[model samples]
Target: MAETMIDVPGYKAGTWVLDPSHSEVTFSVRHMMISKVRGSFGVKSATIVAPENPLEARVEATVDASSIDTNDEGRDTHLRSADFFDVETYPTIEFRSTATRVEAGDLFVDGDLTMHGVTKPVSFELELGGFGVDPWGNYKAGATATTVVNREDFGLTWNAALETGGVLVGKDITITLDLQGSLEQS
Candidate 1:
C-alpha cells in the first residue's frame, strides 16, 4: 500500500488554482427510500488561499446549476425546472468560506452556501490527501470533502408521495468533492 503524507515543502501557504480536468464535484441523494441517485456538476471553479506556515485556509467556489447530470435526460431536464434546482432563474450555486480549522487530521471549512437564491451556513469536512509535483513539474495537491444538506433549506422541496406511505425522495443530499489543485506561480 502506498502511504500518502500531507506535508509538502513550498505548499505550506500560498494561492492554489483548481485544475478542472483533474477535479470533480459530485453529489448523491436518496431516491424512493431505497437507493441513491448520484450526479455531478460539469462546470465548477474554485480557488484556495493558504497562509504561510498556517494550518488553515480559505476557499471559494461556484457551480453551474445547468450542468447537473445523472445520465437521464428527462430527469436532468426536470431538475433544471422549477420542480428542483430551477436552473433558469438561479444559474449558480456558490460557497464562500467564513472560517477554517483543522481537527484530527481533517480540515473543517465553514462557509455560506447559496442555492435557489437562498443562503445558509454549512461546513465541509476536508481531508488533505497530500501534495507533490506531477510529471509535468506542476505542484499538485489532492483533497476530499463532504457535507450533507437538507434540500428543503435550499428551496428544493419538490417531492412525490409514494404509495407505500413515504416520500419519493429524501430531504438530505450528500455532496462529495474530490479536488485537485495546482500551486500558482507568483
Candidate 2:
C-alpha cells in the first residue's frame, strides 16, 4: 500500500494530476437580469506542481470549448457559435498560473486565462478540500475555486435587447471549478 502524507500547511510536494472523472468546471450567468443559466465544460487536461510551499504551486489546465453543456441544446449550440465561444475558431480554453498565495487559511491563484482569442488575468479563491486515500488506494486531493468575470472582456459581447428592457444575456459570468487530483509518488 502506498501512503500519502499531507503536512500541516496542506498539499504534498509532487505532481498532481487532475482526475477529470471526479472534477468539473462550471459557470453561471444571469439570464435577462432575472434568472440564472448554469453550464459546465469538459476539461481536457490539467496539472499542478506543488513545491515545498504548496501556496506557491504552479498550475496549468486546458478545457475543451466545444464540450460546454448548458442542458439546453439550442442554447448550447448558440453559445458554441461565433456570437460566444466560437468553438470552431477557438477550440480550447487555457489557464496558466502566474502566482499563488495563502491568506487567512484561503489560497488564491492569479493566472492568465485565454479564451476566444483574448487573454486576461484572473484570480480565483481556492478552498482546499484536503487529502485522502480513495477506496481504490489512490492518493487524492480536492479543491474548489471560483471567480467572476465580464463576458465582454473576452469578446463574448453578443446579446439581444429584450422587450422587458433587459438584455437577453447577462454580462457577468461566475466560474467555478471542482477539482480532484491524484498525487504522484516520486
Candidate 3:
C-alpha cells in the first residue's frame, strides 16, 4: 500500500506552547574556511498566540545559553567565552515576535531577537507542517522555519584571519527550526 498524506486543519487562533521534547532549535555557521559547524541551544520555554479576528500573531521564546553544545568541549567552551556568546554575563537568548504575516501558506515571524546583550530584528519564515491527534492520545503540530543572521549584528564578532586571506569564521549564521508542539486543551 502507498503512504497516505493527511491534510490537517490549520492551527486555531489561540495560544500554543512549544513542546521542547519534540522541538529542536539549531543553527549552523561556516568554520575554518572549510565547512559549517552546527549547534543547538536548549529551549527553556516558548509561547505563541494568534487572534481569531486578526492575521497576525505573537511569539515569545527563551533559550538557555549555557546549554550550547557542538559535540566538542573545547569549541563549546570557546563559544561561551567572552570571544563569542559570553554566556557568563548573558545567560539567555530571547525572542519576542512583533508581527506575523502569512504568504503562500508559510508564516513569517518578524521579531526582536536578543543575543549576546544585543537586540536585533529578525524574521523566521515558517511552514505549518500539520497537526493531529497522535496514537497515544495527544494533539501534535509541526513547523519548520529557517533564517540567517550576521554574527556581528548580535555582538558575536570574534574571528581569526587565515593565511589564505579569509576569516576563520563566517559572518552569516543559518538557523533552522524544526518544531513539534502539543496543544494543551483547556
Best prediction by lDDT: 2
lDDT of 2 by residue, 40-135 (tens): 999999999988766568999999999999999999999999989999999999999998866565568899999999999999998888888889
lDDT of 1 at 173: 93
Q: Quote the RMSD, in angstroms, for model 3.
A: 5.9
True-vs-predicted CA distance for residue 177, candidate 2, Å: 0.2
Candidate 1 local lDDT, 1-186, one digit each (tens): 222234544465788888899888899999998999999996478999987634457788999999999999999999999999898899999989987766665667789999999999999997778888999888889989899999899999999999987899899999988999998877
| Candidate 1: segments with Cα more than 4 A from true spot | 1-10
**Top model by TM-score, which number?**
2
**Candidate 2 vs. true structure, TM-score:** 0.93
Window of ten residues with lowest summed lDDT in model 2: 1-10
Candidate number that wins on lDDT, 2 or 3: 2
- Per-candidate TM-scores read 0.91, 0.93, 0.90
**Ranking by TM-score, best first?**
2, 1, 3
